[model samples]
Target: MKPGTFLKSTALLDGTFFERSVIFIVEYNDKGAMGFVINNPFPRKLNELEEFKHIIPFPLYLGGPVDQEHLYFVHRRPDLIEGGTPVDAGILLGGDFKAAVKHIDEHTLTGNDIRIFIGYCGWDDGELDAEIAEGSWEVLEGGMLL
Candidate 1:
C-alpha cells in the first residue's frame, strides 16, 4: 500500500503482535515496506523521558515488534524539522528530533502536532504482498491520524 495509508490487522493476525493493530504506512516501495502502529500506545509519554522532560507530554505508541530501543515519529510540520521524508500529501515521516523538541518548547508545536512511536514494522520485498493476499491486513485510507 502507499505511504500514509493504513493497515488494519485482520482476524488472521489474532493473538499475534499485530492483532487489532492499526499501522501507519511510512514507507512503501520496491525495496520493502516500513511503518509504525498508531493505535497500540505504550504506557508512557515522551515528557516522562529525562532527555525530553522539557518538551510537551505526548503518548508514545508501540510502533511494532522490532528494534524496541529505537524511536521514530511522523509529522506534518516539515517546515520545522529538516530531513523529513514525505509519506503522503501533507504528511511526512521522520525528521530532526532536536529541532522538533525545540519547536515544541517554544510553543510552536504541541502533542497534537505529531505522533511519536517506538520501534517499527518492516517487511521484505513481496512478503507484505503475500500477507495481504492471505488476508492478514486490510488497507485503509488515512484518517485524522495521518
Candidate 2:
C-alpha cells in the first residue's frame, strides 16, 4: 500500500485493541508501513497539553498503540501552516508545530482544519502485507474512509 491508503481492521482482528479501528496510512514502503487510528479519542483536550496550552481546546485521539508518549497531527490547512507533508488530497501529515499553534491562537486555523493524534501504528518490512493476507485488515483508498 502507498501513503494515503486506509486500513480497516477486519473480524480477524476481533477481541484485540485494534478491532474496529480505522487507520489513515501516512507512510508505506519496502521497509515498513506507518499510520494512525483516526477514530479513537484519548479523552483529553488539546489545550490541556503543555505545548498546546495557548491554543484553543480540541480533542486528542489515540492514533494507535505505539509510541504513546509522542504527539502527531494531520490537517487540511497547509495554506495556513507551511511545510506540511501531504497525506492525501486536501490532507497533510504534519508541519511546523509552533507555526500551527500560533495560527490557531490567532484564529487563522480552526479545529475543523486539523486533527491531533498521539502514537501511531506500524509494521515492519512485509509484515503489513502478511497481515492483510491473513485477513487482518481491509485496504481501501483514503477518501473512502476520511
Off by over 4 Å in 2: 141-146
The segments of candidate 1 whose C-alpha lies over 4 angstroms from its true place after superposition are none
- lDDT, model 1, position 24: 82
The CA-based lDDT of model 2 is what?
0.84
Positional deviation of 95 in candidate 2, in angstroms? 1.0
Q: Candidate 2's residue-wise lDDT over 25-72, tens digit each? A: 888889899999988888988789887787777777999889999888
lDDT of 1: 0.85
Clashes (candidate 1): 0
User: Per-residue lDDT of 7-104 in model 1, one digit per residue for the tens?
Assistant: 89999999999999998888888999998999988898888988888776767889999898988988889888899888887777889988987887
